[model samples]
Target chain A: MTPQRPTMNDVARTAGVSLKTVSRVVNGETTVAPDLVAKVRAAVESLDYHPHLGASMLRRNDRRTRTIGVLLDDVSHPFSAALHRAVEDQARARGIHVLTGSLDQDPVREQALATAFAERQTDGLILAPTGGDLGHLEAHTGMPVVFVDRIPAGVTGDSVVSTNVSGAAGAVRHLVAQGHRRIGYLGGRRLLSTARERHRGYLRALGSHPGPAVHDLHDPTAAERAAIAMLRAPDPPTALFTTQSMVTTGAVRALRRLGRERSVALIGFDDFPLADLLDPPVTVVAQDPSRMGRTAATALFERIDGYDGPPREIRIPTTLIPRGSGEL
Target chain B: MTPQRPTMNDVARTAGVSLKTVSRVVNGETTVAPDLVAKVRAAVESLDYHPHLGASMLRRNDRRTRTIGVLLDDVSHPFSAALHRAVEDQARARGIHVLTGSLDQDPVREQALATAFAERQTDGLILAPTGGDLGHLEAHTGMPVVFVDRIPAGVTGDSVVSTNVSGAAGAVRHLVAQGHRRIGYLGGRRLLSTARERHRGYLRALGSHPGPAVHDLHDPTAAERAAIAMLRAPDPPTALFTTQSMVTTGAVRALRRLGRERSVALIGFDDFPLADLLDPPVTVVAQDPSRMGRTAATALFERIDGYDGPPREIRIPTTLIPRGSGEL
Candidate 1:
């Protein structure tokens, strides 16, 4: 027969330390004394002790797997990537690891990935919900959930979101103040609450004089096509408000191609890298993804730590940055 | 005592299906017939059965936990995030989950995260190593590993990297063709092989008259400072070559502040979002991060699938896109 695998008890006995000390050392708590740590290490090496995390999770009362799952629209997008990094920073600080998935705005994918994470016993979940209803997640009642970027729909939970309406309104107002009554609107899919909120803000600010508006521009290429069509149409708006960064990029390309970049005033929602360095620097209503991420993480941890308060909604404010594009 | 927990056998018996069929359904594999899948679902619900992933991992001979760990320099960085998404896409297609962490070029963090991942029984690891020696990972002999962005150091394993040296040399030659004999270099830490290789390329291409070169600009702020100092110094270089994207942003800002953006030629390595939208449209030698990421994931999955071949090194090519910036 194969030799019996060494256990934490054996290491403790060989090191002449308590089982608790062995547990602490094995769990990487970092509170043990240096000499004691060395002793435990030596004992562990000699005994070839390997702690089974699966078994430990089953044994522990708290069932702390030390892992959390995150769902985003696309992990590669600049905005989503920033939020992910922030969540990661907070999770790492608490000695927790993150498992991330890109939902890609598919409710089916969101439900399937959430179920997969639950089966793996993730301690909690942070998500930018894609579905209209999170009824599927109701099955995992024990797992704490936090929503970011968009508020939870058909569910009660902690949510951290940007000031989408006010931020978008502010961008439109900035353009209107520049004497642009005929301001075009470029936006994302209406399925997203954030997109809807931004469009609402534009309408509220434009107030009775809405110019040409296009929706469902998911990517830059689509946005570019829409911008080109609108510009070619008779009585095209002198200014434009692109509701998303990718949409903004498409609009910029369209303007550049028509040699109208200098003439058409534009303001994009969401700050992108090298925005200021652009020929006519991009003006933007910048949302703080990092702040939103940190807030969501904090709320999730609070729930995990047994905070049973009523669900809270936190909104991070946005800033309107004035650069050459909007000013023109 | 609480009601006895149900097992896969119990699920199979209740559903009148074979254990293998139950296993396939529980594991989320999509080969089960519609009728059989419906029966399995009903039985699972009635019995209130939940699969214990930990137990399943221990019981399986192939020992696939269906999870992989990824270590990146900073998950928020555009290049790193893009690469991560590519890996995630491939992994998700195979129904594998990803655990990601940011190493921030800290060797200690790299070692600690690697060990943490190993202890959690991740089937494999993909990393951009921050250390010169990967001796720390030797303990996780069972786990397959793949390296990205930079080649493996002391240890040997599968690695997918960019044409750092050749790409840098090509960028320098492009600047030379523009009649720029004096071109300063802005680079990252020499601790990284990529940084060193890039600096070497700069030196080789410059031949007899290498201008002021600065090393260890870790962020955009640092690069901006270095660029400003270099420009203000006596006999400033006629052009600048920034070896990284963040460094390029800094150099661009510095030149703008000095009111010499139009006068000095520049070419940055690594394409970022909106590089073309800049005033003079920043030129760059772009590395195919998506391709690099896809290649790394493919190599990693190959290892996990029991391709026990010798260590392999794969290099993805880079392309030079000439916008107005490098031509000045």
Candidate 2:
């Protein structure tokens, strides 16, 4: 038996109209009469003829596909993933879809992903740019773009980021109050805005402290390697402040490897999974990725809705959770 | 002076072609001659006329928007996020965009998200289904769909999952070897395939060994709550086997709260961040989410490329890493 297919003709017949009228209704052409359009739509629904989405979009003004693009540094990271989920949730409520990509912390990949999203004509873009170059966003004016998490050094657009500097300073103050003088900084790539701002806060907190600042640790791409390096150091800082989740993992791992897990105090910038489970639980400056994501999506939707307000920068606050690791 | 908006006419004029020919080229209609099409393309590139993607797609025969949809239980979970990134990476390489959504572990939400994606006419779909019902996938015919992580109870389709049963059995054997006769199984929602399989493995490993199996521990919906319930039990099992990361966190927290941090043995299913940093570093059955993601993506792309040999189920393996927590 041949399968039956529903077509525009069937819808038109059911609505007692010409096929062109059905086509107009399906494409959402505004020229149709209101009463006739409603009848056509009801017939279309009754026949279960889902208008070809691409065709329907074509006949509409503004030509939006009702989709947005989200690009992150690493989707596997807890913060990035949380933010991604938040954005998706908000987009769903607005009857929009989100296209996601991960740069794996590579700039070339980031550019490629952004271009692909734009070429597909995504209505807007949300990116956590890996600091390399962002000339592409400037060149492409077809879509609205927002930067999330880390802001690009050269390019500026709508951005939503955590208060990294203040959060780091707060963490340092908390450590200092606990009488930690020889505090060492564990950081990620300096190119990232969060890392730079966090490092600045570390320096600001240690400004006149009469201790030798061990700026020996530089960028360790992976957490495992960073942890090993810190543990092998001859005179590791008594108190360690890690700038990111990967760095936090590294610092904790290094302390454990050196059999000094309980001796050194540690506070990480990003809260990670099982932080409190560690022998001496970890203290961290926690940023709400979900809130950041919601704000970014809301901003993009507002732009799509023709809100011509000036591009705004939003900073979400961070909290300090004291677990056992920071008390050592 | 106001900037003159470039139009299709200008592009055709520059390329020395008629408006009809330019329209044909822009819409990817096959009637345009090859040589003229090349000239029109060059002119369009120089003019940077990104043909209204929606309109052009509407005119195309295949009706392919070159977009795929990915639905997961929770995108923020480390494993789910890793899988999402992998799928995105693979799709980007093929010049396809990914529309993503999260079900928040709700079956009703999953069904709604699936419908939303289908309404957009996504070329294919990747789903990590929330348990309950999945009649939607069957209803939406001709769309390629792949199930990841947890498979729906009754629905059958292409699936990629970790070797939960074998991995759990391995963990139990390891615990048995370590001289723990009374092993406790902490699991997530029993409806999940991973949870059920892992629990079965625990029972299989403890064949004929009599002990209390506290299957009453609810799903790790709230890790803190689950942790408290497990710890407060009058006679807690000597070794605790947590089947998911959230459960792992809860169990670890419970141990710490009860001041038995170093007294109880704990082995978790999913490897989490800073597991080794805990006082008695957690032992775990570690599954490589990235590898699983890569494999799943490759399988999906193969299916998308029209390799219809048969619907296949691929299983990735997991490994057990012994740490102080399990040794306890």
Candidate 3:
């Protein structure tokens, strides 16, 4: 039931001009006469003629569609959204367009999306890979791929990630300095590299005392349940180090529900919106997602522009903002 | 430098088979013999052959690209991101991918991006139109266009938006019921229809007792400045009604800075992440962006699937959550 679209020939006939003249005018060539240009424009307006970018790209000398694909964990999440926006900003400045898909931590979806993007002949791809074997991507030879937030497993590529270990360590150390020896750890899925790294840091900073730890608290509800259970235990943690923003939110909710927010100190791994506006303003080790996204995009663009150097492992630093929560 | 990619001919040559046989195997034809398919697969693996979707689409009977373009104000914002994710969820279920762009409220950018998507032959378009005139889009007569979060100004199209006026009125009425006769307004850009609708609602609920108001507080910093000035004035509003999430954040910041957070009553129009964890737990009139996004996508797909119908206007309802702040 698709409507018939007006072709260039139709525009040419309507304008009483040759097909070449219509094409030249539509392409914004300098040689077209002013009257001819006006006639072509009027015809185009009346006929609603839209040029086909795919056809034009097939004839382009450079063979670049000026489009990139971005595959992320979840586009709605604050961290992923920030990264996508940063990439968009850079791509826009360079007159490029972006096609994005959410992988949802599914390796099958990741492979499918990567293949789809490749078939579409995108110039490059930037991805936050799932926690699975990336051996399937080896077949996409010469397709410039840049990983963000996580390093690729079984694949050689440039990656931009946060200093998760140190950031988590710093948070735990800050709580310890507050004389909180019995600390609780709220974290994300164990399979994610970021979560594992942060957990390592927590253990390192906790020294010999391996306080209560919960794994796979991917969502706020799960984390909230875990937090409530831990807080009600006999020897509850004096402080908590939440390894992710969602987990941090769940812990905060649990504390509020228990009316113990002021008594139990907390330091979250990632900084989120309104962190400082809470009752006892949330303390957080904030990762620079914008910087990481910008860096990943820059790396991908470089690869597409013929930078054939060795793969890079770029780690962006994090900052700890101590608000009322950590001090308490 | 772009590397040379292996063509179908190369795969045939390597597999020692006819080009037609290799093509059949690559296209997943059932008539291909198992041995011949294995040979083609081996050759494809060795040569890293990738089928070009552009060339295949030229031969496709239906000529559908199975992709759509989404234009938003800014994808990084929480509301936009949530809406985008909802659209993505629907598109993925139908095996469609999304190409997105940020218009940044610039009419020029909006036109450019729309034209670009049209040139790319996207099956449909979902737009949050800028405040400027949308007459430029009238030329895309047969293109499936669905507006989200705002109605098209001068174009005939399907649209899904929130109940802005009623939601705002509900927030104001909730405050007035709590004996707040002097309520301040923090709003977004005056040019935006949503902001104007909310302002109208506020005025309607106030019933001629026009309290202090601020317009064009598009950002938190600007809203904070306005709120501080309003609060420092001789006649300060006892309560605040912020018409946007960012505006609400600014008002919250202003109250905390003045040490009047517990004393001042605040109700925001849009709910955001961590709103429930704030000191008094932010009271908000939450708009259903996800529902709006899903509805807009469904309508656009219907049009794309050849259901040519008259333009429709769909409004999703809003919810007023009475958290502690609004009851103050």
Candidate 4:
């Protein structure tokens, strides 16, 4: 019932002694009576209670913390938040505690957090790694690490990510099929591998007809400006492909402000709450980030449980749900 | 900079010595040169390094972990997610790590997380406490805890919550002003004080004109069903006031599906992303959860800093944002 491995308290209840006496016996302090110690030891043997961290470390082959570090991009973002929830669900089921940190796409912060979590001897780490030189991480920490949402740039390890490139291409294909020759791409930061892969997919789909591609759009204002500028071009894009939900929101805001909600077709990379309730419901290529998180956590847990297999990269497929905008 | 409290590596860099020498100096091993030890000591002093838990415990007037535990209701929820971000922003500024967990409105889970955090020697705790007997927590854990969003029923502590009753009442008043006498209330689970307070507010506002009031609607599906059923009633409600964002989304979905979006006036309790982009942009009694989070975290930090002031219950006011739904 306590979110801990069988504790000394459980032993005390079985041994008919106080927690203090149980602690004394467990710590091998000599002052306790032999009979009480024997009782406590018998109870401990029966209950399988490792007194504390030190005892557990001494007894088990693995110096298990029963805690995992989860470094996400931003827990405030719905995708990251949902992923956190999913990971937590799995960890709770396993009686593990997850310590979370928001990396905020800062590689230095990512490394710093990973280092701290390692210092605490966490069972493993789940990282939605930020871009830049992350090769140092695997060697520097010497800890089991699993990548989530996006693969780490340098070292190949256990990772679960959405098929970003394919999903983006599929979105473009959907737009193209709807007779849209020119589609604007409003993507996330170029530094992110997600953005890069999605951009590649966009280009792959737009092999012949390359439209205006704007990368490094995170804030709604920047996205709105980029979308508006693209809309106002001499040859405007008839359709817009936003790489993220927030970007989609910005583009939608711009459309509404410009009174072109129904005129320009929009399909976003992520699905958000109330997307269908929009004036002209926004179509989206949705990635299952929660499933990705669960998969990544499971993979990490497998590694922690001594699964010595080659690193696997699991790709979760994205789905395109059309409401009103993508068809037009 | 590393997220760790100044480490041996940091001392080595500051003192311009090898990490080995720094470790030797720190560990008080006899092999370190006097000059090197002096340099390391100077660097440690200048960097304000508290070497480890034991050293910090010995040195400090108040043993601080520089880590805070945040137990949110459900971090995946937009409200809780935003709150987490806000709290993290404040903690990061103070060079403190925020260890987060979603309690899922489970009292047992809350206690377990609190105990785990306490075991880890977290400096303080911020809880969006689940409803139940949490009286033992203050005395049992011996940790400073600040409640956010909902108050702890048994024990008194610093808490920051929205003006739920007033907010809901204000929202109902807005709906009534638009000539809606029969309004439906789609609220959250009754176990939550936030939900109960909001329901109380709804009743307060409808003191004279009692309408269809449905409580304990947690998910969007329930909200949608309640809305649909209420709409189908012989004396159906003309307006809907959903207490939460998710509930509002469900009601909106149902209304949209029923093609009664324009017909039924709606005002949601919490504001969410893309609310303004909806066909008839959802009117909401907006609670500033981020600000509430920041306030709760600040209050917690104050307590952590040895502020023995009486527990403060800070109530953040809510705003009624009227777009078109409420106006209708």
Better of 3 and 4 by TM-score: 3
A1-328: candidate 1 lDDT, tens digit per residue: 5254467889999999999999999878889998999999999988757787777887787778899999999988989999999999999999999999998898889988988888788989999998566886845435789999987668888889889999999999999999888999999988787889999999999888899999989899999999999999999999999999999999989999999988999999999887787768889999999998998998999998889899898999999999889988
Q: What does the lDDT read for residue B263 in candidate 1?
A: 95
TM-score of 3: 0.92
lDDT of 1 at A29: 88
- Per-residue C-alpha lDDT of model 3 across residues A46-81, encoded as one tens digit per residue: 888887777667767777878899999999899999
Tens-digit per-residue lDDT, A181-236, candidate 2: 87877777777888888888888888776233323243333564655565567865
* Regions of model 2 farther than 4 Å from truth: A1-7, A13-17, A20-48, A208-236, B1-10, B19-42, B208-210, B214-236
TM-score of chain B of 1: 0.90
CAPRI band for model 2 = medium
How do the predictions measure up, each by TM-score? Answer: 0.91, 0.87, 0.92, 0.86
lDDT of 2 at A255: 75
Estimate the lDDT of model 4.
0.85
Q: List the residue pairs that clash in candidate 4.
A: none
Instruction: Mark the 10 consecutive residues where model 2 chain B has the least summed lDDT.
Output: B210-219
Clashing pairs in 3: none
Which should have the higher TM-score, number 2 or number 3? 3
Residue A268 lDDT (model 3): 96
CAPRI grade of model 1:
medium
DockQ for all models: 0.61, 0.63, 0.74, 0.40
